[model samples]
Target: MKYIVVKLGGSTLEQLPPTFYKNIVELHQSKEWSPIIVHGGGPLISSLLKSLQIETQFINGLRVTDQNVLDIVEMVLSGSVNKQIVRHLISAKGNAFGISGVDGGLLNSQPVEGAKELGFVGEVVDVNTDMIKEIIQKGYIPVISPIGIDENGQRYNINGDIAASAIASALGANLCLISDIPGIYIEKDNIKHTLKNITKAEVEAMIEDGQIFGGMIPKVKAAIDGLVHDVPEVSIINGLEVDSLIAYCNGEEIGTKIVLNKESSYVK
Candidate 1:
């Protein structure tokens, strides 16, 4: 079966716009392809930490996951956010199951000891695909949380983008990242949207030239990694659009498609 792995950003999750859910359901009923969802819960985790009076920090866009922050990350990402997405999918008639990187040793990781002060954040070293395959074989969409396990059986927090990219790469699936904006904009404030197909090198040059900066930097980097790792195509689409995901999956041009090399134009 043709497979696509989609990473829904935390901001998108918080919005939970009706149109987004409807499109997902519509695609779920299509039976043309299988989708595996990997989601992030950064905003929720931050809110929860504030409620608990825990200070939050970030180093190079990744949360500085000390033990306490790691606890909150697991709670929000694995417990609350994971279940919320699973419930939404099931309610929409999409067969969905919630899972984490730690379940069944799905993602084995090593501590990112580059900065010892960062505590329990991890980098994925291995991915066990058996459990994911089992769920796919059973006809259930696997909705994954980003928490991972370390060599010493310790749980560690992981960057959601990194986690999602790793899962897509391991599965050799087409990857899509759903965000609030319409892909990577050449100018964030400008109303004009450039939806042209682009290459990894072109994106890098844009970044170097300052056309792409700020929040888009990491996302484009993630897309580049996915393309380089053998996933044929990666896209960044507007999550708020009613049928953006379905349109992209059906080969209808609705988002910015990132590719490794320039090729003949073909949609659908």
Candidate 2:
């Protein structure tokens, strides 16, 4: 089965139009692709923590996740955010089922090396595809939360971008990173334009030159990683668009697609 692994950013998860979910149904009806979603919930988690009077902070764009923070992160990502995506799909006449990395050993991870200061945040060591495969085989889109587990059954928070990339690598699937932004942009002669295509080397240079910084640094890195690891394709697209998802699946040029080399890049 051809799989399209989508990573939905939390910034616009709740606000995605019904058309986006309708495109998901189109993928199912097309009989050529299976959609699996991996989602993040940063804004909602922060909102809930603030309302609950729990203090939290990020170190270099990575959330500091102590036990208190991990509890809230999981609750938001696995509960509210995951359900909202699944419900939205179903409401649009699509079938979706939500799961977390903690469920059925979907993601086994260990604490990120040299970043112990970040607390329970971990790097995904492996992705178990059995559960996700079964869900897709049954015709339900699997919505995943980036909450990982260790062999000892300890839960760790995984960066959604990294988790999505790792899962794509494990499955050798196409990855579409859905976010609030349409695509990466460059300024020339004071005109800013979104780049429809870019090469991995160009993106690396952009990151090194600090042209790419903050959270986008990680997403770009994840996209590049997916490409390097043999994922057929990877794109960072605007999730808020009415047809971005379908356009990507249909091979239309609409979002920022990352490529292994300039041979596949058509940056105009």
lDDT agreement of model 1 with the native: 0.80
Give model 2's TM-score versus the native structure: 0.94
lDDT of 2: 0.87
Taking all chains together, each candidate's TM-score versus the true structure is 0.89, 0.94
Q: Which ten residues in a row have the lowest lDDT in candidate 2?
A: 259-268
**Residue-wise C-alpha lDDT for candidate 2, range 1-268, written one tens digit per residue:** 5888999887878778889889888898788998889999999999999999999888656788999999999999999889988888888888899999999999999998646689999988889898888888888989999999999999999989999999999998999999888789887778777888889888888888777788888788888888888888898899798898987877898878888676544333
- Candidate 1 is scored at a TM of 0.89
Count clashing residue pairs per candidate: 0, 0
Worst 10 residues of 1 by lDDT: 259-268
